[model samples]
Target: MKKSDINQYGLKPVPDPKGNSTGKAAGKAISRVVITIVSLFFATLFIIGIFMFSYIMSLRGEEIDIDLHSLNLDYTSFIYVNDESGNPVEYKSLYGGESNRIWVDYQDIPQYMKDAMVAIEDKRFWEHNGVDWWRTLGAASNLLSSGGSFGGSTITQQLIKNLTGESDVSISRKLKEIFRAENLEKKYTKEEILECYLNVVNFGSGCKGVQAAANLYFGKDIKDCSLAECAAIAGITQNPYAYSPMNFPDQNKERQQIVLSEMYNQEKITKEEYDQAMSESENMNFVFQEATETGADDTINNWYIDTMIQDVVSDLQSELGYTKEDAQNMIYYGGLKIYSAMDSSAQEMAENAVANDRNLNSDPDMQCGVYMMDYSGRVLAIVGSSDEKEGNMWFNYATDAKRQPGSSFKPIAAYAPAIDKGIINYSSIVQDEPIPNYFDDGTAGPNNYDHQFRGPVTVQYALQQSYNPPAVRVYQQLGPQNAYNFLTQKLGFTSLVGGGVDDSNLGVAIGGVHEGVTVKEMTAAFQIFGNGGQYNEPYTYYYVEDHDGNVILDNRDNISTQAIKSSTATIMQKLLTTVVTQGTGTGAGVTGWQIYGKTGTTDIDDNSYFVGGSPYAVIGVWTGYQNPSRLRNTNASKSVFQSLMGAYLNTKQLKQFTTDSSVTSAVYCTQSGNLAGPGCPTATGWYERSNMPSECTQHQNTNTTSSRSEEEEESSSSNTSSSESSSSSSSSSSSSSSSSSASSSSSSSAA
Candidate 1:
C-alpha cells in the first residue's frame, strides 16, 4: 500500500478506497430512509381502508332498527283511501308526483325489467363487488382523450349513491359510493337491492318508485307494462324529463328505441321483441286546459279548497298535536291514510248543478261552494267549484267562512225554540205588520223581503214567505236568550254567540245580530236532528295503524253526547219537513222521500245557502263572492238549496243505509210551530196548511179577502181549516225519549 502511494502523490484517485467506503455508507442510509417512508405511507392507507370498511358495514340494512310501529310519519300527500268499490276517491301528491309511490318485493319484478336495466346501465352488475378497476381505467382513458366525463359506475354503486344520497362528482365521493355498495352487497341479496333501487328512483312530475312511473306513463300496472312502455321507462333512468314522452314524444320514442337496441345487443330481449318495441307507436294523449283572458277579476280561483286547507291547518293545530311545521310536513310528506267522509256522488252532483245552472254559469266569475255530511257529523264530500281544475279555492267554505247567516240562522234561533217550547202550533196566527224595536237610535222595525208588510198572517205563512217582520215578533216573544240558548246550549252550535252579544236572543234569532256563522256550524246544527240528537265530533281518520299493522288509534265505534231529547229533535224534524215540502225550501224536497231543509240568503246577496238533511245525511251549499260584494248579475232568484239536494239525494252512497220511515208530513207554523191549533184558522192554502183544524187558534188564521168576495172566501176558508188542523205537528215529545237508551249505550262505549 506504501508503494501504491503514487496514487495519492499524483492525484486524488477516482477509485479511492476511502471514497468507496463513504459511498457504501451513504447508500445504506438512503435505503433505510426509503424503506421507512414507504412503510408509513402503506400503514396510513391500511388504517384508512379499515376505518372506511367499518363505517360502511355499520350502515347495513340489518343494522337499522327503526320502529316501524311508531313512525308518526304522516304521508298524507301521497295516499288516498279508496271507496267501497276499491276506486280511489282522492289524490295525494308528494315529491311532485301525480300519485303515491308503491313498493313491491324484489321477486315481484318482471325478469325482463331486471334484464333490461342490466343491459342498459351495468352489464357487469353481478361480477363487480363495488368498483371495477378495468372499467375505471377505460373510462379514465376515454375522459383524457375526449375531454368528456364517462360513468364507470356499476348498478350497486349507483344504488348506493341513491339510497345513501351521496354525491357523485368527485373521486372521493365515488370512493365512498364504492365502499357503501360493497357493504350493501354483503347485507342484502341482489334481488332486494334491485327492487329497492327501482322503487327509490325518480321519474318525472315529482313521481317516485317504479309503480307510479308505470301507471303515469302507460296507464297500466308494472306487472302489466308493455315492452314499448318498459323501454320508455328504462330510457328515463338517467334524465327523466329528458326522455319524457309528455314533453318530447318523438325524441322519447327514439330514446326508447335506443334502449331497445341496447337490450337486444346485450341479449336481454329477443330480436323480434326489440323490433316490435322499436316499431310501436309513441302517441301520448295528455290533457291540458286552455286559459282565457277575462275582464272580470276572480280572487282565490279555488278559494273553496284553499279555505279548507287553511281550516284543516287550524284544526290540526288546535285539535291534534301538530305544529305549523309538523302540519305542513304531514300534508307534503306523511303517508297518512285519510278516510274523508265526503260523498263523491254528492260532490259530483253539487258541482254539476252549479256548473250547469245557466244563471250561475252566465257570470263566468261566479263560483259555488258545496259540502255534504253524514248525520253522524262526518263530512262526506266538499266542492268549491263546478270545475276541479279551477283549484280548491272553494275549499273550507263550510268551516273557515264567517258570514251572516241571514234568514238561514232563523230556524236555529226562532223556529226551533218555538216548536220546542210549544209557544205555538204549526198553524199559529201572527201579524206580519211592522213591530218597532228600540235600537240605540231608538227607531227600528223589521220588513218582508220586498220591504212591505203582509199584515195579519199565520206563522206558517210568515216563515214560508221569509217575512222578516213575523220572525222579529217571534224573536221578541221568545226572548233573545232563549233563542241563543237553543242554538248554542241545545243545538250545540258554537258559531252563533260571542263578541259583544251578552245573551243569544231575538237579535240572534232573526240574524239581526251575530258575530258570524261558518257553514260547518250552521250545517251541523241541522245534522243533529238528522242523527236523532247525537252530537259526535266530526272526524275523517277512521283508524291509524303502524307498518306492522298494530293499531295506534281506532274510531270504528265512536259515539257522542245527545244534544237534545229525541222527542224534541222529532219536533224540529217535523217543522223542517214543512220547509222542504211546502215552505221556502220547497225546492229542496226530494221525490219519494221525506225531506227537511232551510234556505238562507244574506244581505247584499253576498251569500246564499241551503242546508238540509235526510235520515242518512245532511248537506249545506254556499254561493258568494269572497270580496263581500254581491255576485254581479246573480238573480238571487235561483235556490242554492235545490242544487245541493238535487246532487245529494241521487248519490249511491246514501242508498247504502236503509230508509227510516219515521219522518213525514209538511207545513208547520213558525210562531207556535205546530199543526193548526186554537191559535190558527186555516183558509185555503197549500196541503201543509189545509191539513189542520180550527182548534189551532194560535197556529193559523183566516185571511181577510176583498169584501165583495167574502161569500166564496168563507166557503174556501171553511174547507181549509178542517184539513189544515189535521195536517202535521212539528213536535215529537214521544220519539226522542224512547231512543235514548240504545243511543246512550253505544255512545258511552265509544267514549
Candidate 2:
C-alpha cells in the first residue's frame, strides 16, 4: 500500500483478498490489525498525559534554570563618535550574548508586521492556550493516513522550546514542551509572547531578532519596515540558515509570498497591501553594510573598540552599581548607545601607519604597538598588533602589554620630576659617571648606548643624548621613593608596584622599573609636556545612554591635574624640542609641526620606543619582539612614530604650545652652562624665573665651535643593537652608527 493511503486511513487490506478460500480469515485479520492500530494510537496519547503529570510532580522539588517571570532578552549595543560635521557615526556594535539580538519594544513594532508574523507562524495564536487543538487534530489525522511524524507546534510551544534551549525529538520532550507552553500562555499576554518570539528568533547572518535583521538586510530601522520587508523577516523563522534574507534571497522570495498569502487569507492585511507586498517582493534587493566603504568587518575588534569596551565596562561597574559580568551583559543587551572618544580620521591614520608591514622593516614575528591621544586625555586611536587582523577581542599590546620604555622613561621618570623639584634645570651641570650605593653590592654601573662616559654634561645635553648616567645622577638627587611617588601618584603609572624595594634603584632612570610601562601609561605621562603641566586620565568614551535615551553614565568627569609646575613643564618642553631639532629624535619630526619627544633604546637594543607630543596629539610607539630579544632594526620605530604623529598634524588645526609667564629664555655659556658673559661662547636655554643661573664670569672660552655635532645626531638612527651582539647603544649616536654598519654585514651573512 502507498504511504499516502496509510496516512489517510487506518491499516486496510491491500487489493482485497485475491483468493476466495481465505477471504473470511483475511477479513478477520484486517479487523484485528485496525483495532490494534487504533488502540496503540489512543494509548500513546494517554501515556503522554500521564508522563507530563509525573513531570509536574518532579518539578515541585527541583526547579529549572529558566525563570519564566523574568522574561529577559538581550540586544546589541552601539559605539559612536561625532564626525567632523558633528554628526554621530557608528564605529562598532557589541551584542549582549552569543546570540546577536537587538531588542525592539512592542510599541516600536509595526502593526502590519505583527499581523504578518501571526498569520504565518500561528493563526490562532491569539485564541489558543499555547497548544492549538484544531491544528493538533488535523496534524494527527494527516499522520494516521501518511505515517508522518508530528509537525504542528504553536507559537507558544516554539517559544517554550526556545526558552528552555531544548531540541530533543523524543515523545517526552514534545509532551513537556506542550504543557509548559500552555502554562506560558496562561501567565503572559499574547502581545508579550509575540514580542519575545520576534526578538529571540534567529534570522541568519549572525543576526537575531527583527532589529538585527532589519539593520542587516534592509539598512533601515524596524519601525520603518515595509510590508514586504516584514513578510521577509517573518518567513526566516521557518529555517533561518536555508532562507536567510541575506544568504538565500531567492528562497526567501518564495517563503515571503507564502507569508503574504497567509496574511491576506486571514484578512490581517488588505488586498491592496497584499498586491503591493507581492510586487515589492518580486524585485527585492538586499543591501549589506559590508558592501559600504564605512562598514568594518564585525568579526574584527580593532584597538579602539577594545579600549572602549574596557573603559565602558570599568565605568559601568562604578557608576551603575553593576558587577563586571553584569555590566558587560547590560552593555551588550541593554541597547545602549555609547558616545566614544574615538576620532575616526585619527583611528584610520594610526591603523594604516602600524599595519603597514613592509615599512616596519622586521620579520612578521616582530610586533609593534601605538597609542595616540589629545591633550584632554581623549584617546583617538590605538594599534595593538603588527599582524593582519584575523578575529576579535584579542590581546591589545597598547593597553595590556607592560614592555620596557627604554630611554623613553628619561623624560618621565628622571628629567621631568627633577626639573619640577628644583633639583635640576635646563642647563644644570650633571656628571656622566656611575652612581654610588645604587646596587645591593653597594656598587653601580652606568648604562649607555656606546658604553662610554661623556664626563660632565649639561642637563639638556644629557637628555638630548639619552645618557643613562646623567639620568641616574638626577634620579638619585630626586630620590627613588620620591620619583616613584611622582610617577604613581601624580602621573598614574600603575605598573611601578615597588613594594618598597624593587624599584628603589637606578633602573627607572633607563626605563627599568620593577615592572614595565604600558604604551597607554607612557603616552598619558607625556601629556604634562603637551598640555603645559596638566595630565588628564586617558578615556575612550564621553557617555553612555540607555535604550530610551536617558544618560546612564557620564565619563566626561575625568579631571586634569597639574602633574608638574607650568614653568617646569615649559622648560622641559623646550628641551625636548632640542632633542628633535639637534638630537636623536630628528628622524621622528613632521615638517610643519613642532615635534618634541624623546627617543629610547634598551641597553641590549631589544626594544625601541619613541614618546613625544605635537601641538595636536601625544604619541607613543613601541617596536620589538613580544619576548625580550634584540630588535632587528630600531630605526623602523621612529619612522612609524613619525607617521602616527603626522596623522594628527595633517588633520587637526595647528595650535602652538602654550607658554607660561614664569618661563623665560636666556643666553648661557656653552662651556660653563651658566649665564654668558663677555667673550663667552653661548647658546640659548629656557629656565623657570625662580631657577635662573648666575653669570658665568668663570668661563673664558675662545673657541666659537658648536657645543653638539651633526654627526652625533645621526648616530641613533643607524647604530641599532641586535641579538647577535653586533652593537649596543641607547638611542645611538654616530659613533656606533658607522661602526655597526660595517659590523652588521658580517652578522647578517652568518645568520
Which candidate gets the maximum lDDT versus the true structure? 2
Clashes of 2: 12
TM-score to native of every candidate shown: 0.51, 0.62
Which candidate number would show the highest TM-score if scored against the true structure?
2
Q: What does the lDDT come to for candidate 1?
A: 0.54
Candidate 1 lDDT tens digits, 630-732: 5553332235555566556665344422222433344333333344343332233222222332333442354632122222333343332211011010111
Q: Alpha carbon lDDT of residue 38, candidate 1? A: 100
Model 2 agreement with the true structure over 1-751: per-residue lDDT tens digits: 8765775676654454457758888899999999999999999989998997887766433223454446665456888888898788987677545436567889999987788889998999888888898887887777678966555889877776566544434556666766777767666798888888877776655466788778777888779989999999889877765677554678889999999999999998899989999999999967753212223356446778867877786887776655553454455566889998888888888888887745474577778888999889899899888876543334677888877676778888889998998888888889877555443344445435655666787888787766767887887788777877898899998777643444555566666654567889999999899788999999888888988899998767888899999998888899898778767777788987788988767656666778899988899988878787877777667788888787668766877888889989998865677887766656788988878999987644645434443235334533332111222232221111111111111110000
Runs with alpha carbons beyond 4 Å of true place in candidate 1: 1-78, 85-320, 386-395, 490-492, 497-505, 546-555, 632-640, 651-751
Report the number of clashing residue pairs per model: 76, 12
Return the TM-score for candidate 2, rounded to 2 decimals: 0.62
